[model samples]
Target: MNRIFATSICVILATSAAAAEVELSFYGGVQSAPSSDVSIRDDDSIPDGDFSIAWEGRSLEAPPYYGIRATKWRSPEFGYGLDFTHNKVYPENDELPAGYDVLEFTDGLNTLTVNAYRRWSSAFGEVSPYIGGGVGVSVPYVEVANSDSETFSYQLTGPAATWIAGASYPINDQWSVFGEYKGTFSSNTADLDTGGTLETDIVTNAVNLGLSFNF
Candidate 1:
């Protein structure tokens, strides 16, 4: 199986006869945290401890996202690339436990994704309007504050499906900039491993601006 996959890639590189120059891009920008569903179990009851979400999660601020992408244009209108980007959001508010009025909370969700995308671009004078999409998995990290004032933590290790869309313009032969939106959908909201069961789907949508180099 590994040999067959390797051979397929080799065939692609070899048959890239009509390929344009490969493009390497780096970008950074802000992402609006998507609305998520969250819940925390206050007790331990095995596989049936009321596995349900009770809170809707939202971001108090826009988090930052950044990444690098390498694309191979097989032709002027068609191309494929490997894209890796990061998008994250922090917990803004928490429903306090019964007696405590404050949780002194400090935690957030961080997602890093590696994706494969197909893109189509059209040229109008010096500007190129393009649309593309990718399917990938997002690796999420849930950080729960553990301190004297805080008393819980969590560890998440899994990949969730992700998607993206965007467009870009060429400033010159070697330079270009782009604006794109990315969405990362997760399946962790149903069951999260934490001090308590912290249930929240870490979905995100980010608008990014980046620079590209053709080499």
Candidate 2:
């Protein structure tokens, strides 16, 4: 009877310790303050009486985003993670007007990014501060409702970069919450065969609210 009681107590302690071995976390909210800027070109040379012309500028606003991250600690202070995120921004108008030309544009900005990052925990309660960057791809779609006489469309997919800084806190043994600010950068260029080519650059600034899990 004594041996049986000792074994039962040992099993309970082992189970409790094992439960702390792994942690899962989740978080969600809103990301405010988003800004974007782009440059567009139709030609570089004058056709008849005109000269070279181009338009480029920047804009700022508050934008929102959501994401999820899973981290598994190989040790206490350091761990590896997988992160996924989504962002959506709409254009103010379907048509963009220039000095002498008008462009019919449809659709906004939509993207999903995935990357791997390293996490670090500090003295703050169950919370930790982390900084990491990864490379991914950006897919942007645009529709031209009226291209002179015919409608035209194209897609942009290329290399992009993601950098984040945020804090995360544990709610329990298996769950936690996180918030971060992320920036994405990319560009696209094309040749039209007529005169000069067209080049478009897009930059997205976003605030991210989401959750983190450890196992």
The runs of at least 3 residues in candidate 2 whose Cα sits more than 4 Å from the true structure, single-residue gaps closed, are: 1-65, 68-74, 77-82, 92-95, 99-116, 147-156, 189-198
**Candidate 1: where is the Cα deviation over 4 Å?**
1-20, 41-64, 93-120, 146-156, 189-197
lDDT of 1 by residue, 59-118 (tens): 333333456666787677767765555554543445433433322212333343344555
Clashing pairs in 1: none
lDDT for 1 in candidate 2 is 19
Could you give candidate 2's per-residue lDDT for residues 1-215 as a string of tens digits? Answer: 12222333354344334654433333334422223343334443312222222222112223224444444465665554444333434433322433323221112233334444556666675678877676655444333222332223334445666677787777776567777777656554433333333344556565556654444
TM-score for each predicted model, relative to the true structure = 0.62, 0.56
Candidate 1 TM-score, C-alpha based? 0.62
